[model samples]
Target: MSDRRATVVRDLVRRLLDDADGAGTAPIVQVGHPVLRAAAFPCDGQLDDADLAQLVALMQRTMRAAPGVGLAAPQIGIPLALAVVEDPGVDDAEVARVRERDRLPFRVLVNPAYEPVGEDRVGFYEGCLSVVGYQAVVARPRSVRLRAHDASGAVVDEVVTGWAARIVQHEMDHLRGTLYLDRAEMRSLSATDRLGAHWASQPVPLEASRALGFALPTPAGPGGAAPR
Candidate 1:
């Protein structure tokens, strides 16, 4: 993230938190933003600042509000070198053992750089919040290596396979100003013609209750709300 944009986000988030009216929310620039076109600012030095902290907070709230599992700084029009990933814990050992393979645990990468280490593989059905109404099938590596600086600025190199690897690669692309659309072989805006299923699906909510916190059709029934 550029120091300039980071500074802006820090101030902006403070304003939003104080009022909480939601009027001070930052606008996510669409595909037309000049910042999205070319280069993403690199972290010049230590990322210790209010902006970095604010980015993390804003990203979390934005992701939750938008109902997405992961969100990056660039998506919100702040070109930062960080991303926030809320892990949906899955039984990885069972998944990997089923196929006789190994996969790493979930991680939150900051300033990550992805490089192919082994056989190359491609993927599709990537959805971007910036292109909200569209879904694109892009091809990226099936296995990859990542190098990044930790919160303390210590260099750490990691490796992984399968979807976990894909997540890092996808986020790293954002840090470089490249969207999955750039690498997509096929693109569509929600299964207009040739319909296909997405490899990764968005998380679905289980249920929604009203403001009164009562189950539907349950004022005095078996499923009625108990005394608080």
Candidate 2:
């Protein structure tokens, strides 16, 4: 969130916008990019409705193609306080019941922020489109109150629970240049491909913690199981 980083993000945004011409998917910015570490500019009045709509559509398309549940503007090199999220969910009833993950409709969040709703938290292996190929266990609040504006500039204020809340927090962190790794349990970090071979059966990080020889921070009381 340094001034230099912010300046770099702004320059990148301008360059990306200038070059946008109904082209193919905008390449997702990778983990080491300076723009990904910079706080984003607020979306208010930055683009007219038409441009904003176009940009949101582009983001949605890119996110869907990535097959990810959420995407932040900075992930695509446009450091604006905007993101898109959606989760069609998996068909496994057991996994869904444990993770508290259900289907979430697509949503566009502009200048979104979240507040932890309670003391309860859950640790789950989380991944990011920007930080592709790796996953790690990060503890997040079980629920949150989200405040933001939708694509139409309408106010959005709601309390989301379980997996939906996690998605919100993950995307909101991007606006502040915060990646999940910033709050992850480093010992539990694993390559995406190795998850099925090692940690897929463990509903929580406890087993992984024991296997990896690292202490897993226990959540406050019981709330929900870990992510898949």
Candidate 3:
């Protein structure tokens, strides 16, 4: 059924994009959509090679256009276990160092999953394209072991750390029908403007936690500090 459904979805998305005023992108579905709340269908050979490539290309274009670090299929009204992630990085060396954020090349993840590598946790402000206009602080594992198939159906298994790990975990959560807000410290939610205006200077979110009157998990191991 998923395989047949994949064909239907691919055709539907193409038509939707065609009608999107030649922008070559589709509208990202916002939060509260049923598709975003349901577990996505696994992408195990559901799409043939050509169809898979086309879908990946469209997803990449949409993700780049949204100007987000990552995007999951459910975010676009396609409930498939797929996502694209990339980060060009910030120019400020101090900020990058504090957040452990570096240049991350664009990559496609199919049926991706991850597990925490250790007990250490770090809290940082996170926002989703689906949950537009808001950002919140969430604590997550500082390192994780990622297991997935690449665009070419090759296995990918490795340990990712720092900001990269955070990106992986966030996207994988979408495949499992979860959102950042589900795990977020609710009190720390802030409007996008307020986040930049009030908490942008605080790198690790510690100050926001303090000001917001919320508790943050302590770093349990090395390289674990308050990150931007």
Candidate 4:
């Protein structure tokens, strides 16, 4: 880590320790926070096992409490390259078919990186814990090859597809100081309540994409393979 990044990590450690006693969720830093804009420092074994484990646990708790699929360190105001992801698994058959979501065991990623596995893309409504209260139509690669370390510093390398891949990309972008809105159809952005009220049933609305001057993927047949 650079001197500046080291300083940032030191400050983060102090802040985390100060709040260690607090109850409830860790405060998620919002869009305009400087920490969210700056590229996070690579963990690179800088944090000892105990501290690393504690931080990962805190992040997992915060993410579950938020009821979100993923969380990145920057979202909780830590400028470190770390993230946690889990999906209790989607139960609705239709929802599951559309999203290709499945049960994902809780996993930790440190100093992570990913690359698109194919030209295929899936466009869907995505919201963020940090962004809060809005959802937008953003398209991302449907599969990715990931490389990272577990909380114990063990190497992790795998290919992930479907909803899990989207979660990975979203969280990784946080560490890179990017947001879904940066790649979303701005005109298709909608309030959370409004989405549930009017757009919840549609996988991807054609009218919304037309209004936003973009085309979304055409749905494959029932039980068909994911959009390519």
Candidate 5:
């Protein structure tokens, strides 16, 4: 990340800590907390080896227990640039088909970064563990090239697509002090209950965008598009 961005993240962390005034650890840090907005530190060699492994294990367990596809270290009040992601496959075939949701085995990413892979863009309603109870339509590149390290500090470079790609991007954004809300179509933002009641079957609803007074991005043709 750029130095300016890093400084902004540090400021955010300071503000959050000031507000908390030395509170105990919570199950998951929520929005408005500095940890969630601050850039996390690279974990490689910066932490005790055994301790890092334990933290990774705890993050994985917490993610699964939260019933989320991914979790970042900052979400649990740790400021290390670490995240864990896994999808145990969806049962709803239509939902799976629309989102390209598929089985993803457990994986860990440390100090991750990603770039757009192709021009194809897909819009989906995204929710977050930190920003609970709300979902919003966000268009993202359909594929990405990820560069990062695993829990053991091995390099990980690969092309990721479909829902897996979305998961990766979301977690990486956390590392960079970005949130899905920063990229979401404000008009498409809805409560989870509202989404289930009305927009459950839709892809990206133009009506919602219209009502929200924001324009959605035009879909790009098959080539590399910018990251969301």
Candidate 6:
């Protein structure tokens, strides 16, 4: 475990504390919950109670299920102004998670900030587990120089480069009550036409061939995703 590890529970903490009523009894949060979509909350002092810890667990589970690399409490309807990020890619530290990790889940965050570490920007397509059903093209900083808190309540700062940076930006937007749609600058072109023309530029897997029973052209590369 990293020295600055965000307080790991070894596996699932919920089961251990399931009967503990106060710290492990938080309910799952859903999209559209007033708490999930709130922006800019100050939870440093007011959010350390039992409900807060339970809420943290719920957010951790929700983010993992979304198959996300990191998640903020606000995204799961808890507007405590904090985020939980588990960098599975730390092992790879290269690609932006082409696949999810099977074990050793982590949540490292308290009151983290997403500051750009580099001036470079890259265009990438993004999808949201919350919005559902589609992907969009958007642009984000290729790397972000940021400082955030670890789960242990420690301030850990590192330059989040590459896909990790993307994850940070994506989650940060959620904290601010912003969605990918907020960053979408592309003209709302029809999905069918754009896909047809850009099929060769996509990186779709063969198993994902059909959308609504009709297949878009075979997804082909790094450029397959639309830029935001």
Best by TM-score: 3
TM-score of each: 0.64, 0.88, 0.92, 0.89, 0.80, 0.61
Off by over 4 Å in 4: 22-24, 210-213, 218-228
Runs in model 1 deviating more than 4 A are: 1-27, 45-47, 89-108, 187-228
Cα-based lDDT for every prediction: 0.54, 0.82, 0.83, 0.82, 0.77, 0.53
Q: What is candidate 4's lDDT per residue for 91-174, written digit by digit as tens?
A: 677778768788889999999999998677778889999888999888788889999998877899999988899899999999
Q: Please estimate how well model 3 matches the true structure, expressed as its whole-model Cα lDDT.
A: 0.83
Candidate 1 structure quality by residue, lDDT tens digits, 1-228: 556776765564455545544323445557777656655566654345554555566666776677555666677765557766654545555434322233333334577787896555533345666666666545456667878875456786977665566667777777788877787644222441222343222221002122212232212211121222
lDDT of 5: 0.77
> Tens digit of lDDT per residue, candidate 5, span 1-49?
5566556545544444444344422278899999888888876454557
RMSD of each: 14.1, 3.6, 2.3, 2.7, 6.5, 9.7
User: Candidate 4, after superposition: displacement of residue 154 in Å?
Assistant: 1.6
Better model by TM-score: candidate 1 vs candidate 3: 3
The per-residue C-alpha lDDT of model 3 at residue 198 equals: 93
Q: Which parts of model 2 are misplaced by more than 4 Å?
A: 1-23, 217-228
Best by lDDT: 3
For TM-score, candidate 2 versus 3, the one ahead is 3
How would the candidate models be sorted by TM-score, starting from the highest? Answer: 3, 4, 2, 5, 1, 6
Q: Candidate 3: worst 10 consecutive residues by lDDT?
A: 219-228
| Residue pairs clashing, model 3 | 203-227, 203-228, 204-226, 204-227
Q: Local error of candidate 2 at 13, Å? A: 6.0
lDDT of candidate 3 over 30-93, digit per residue (tens): 8888988899988866667876777777788888998988988888887789999999987877
* Tens digit per residue, CA lDDT, model 6, 196-227: 45542433322223321222222322322222
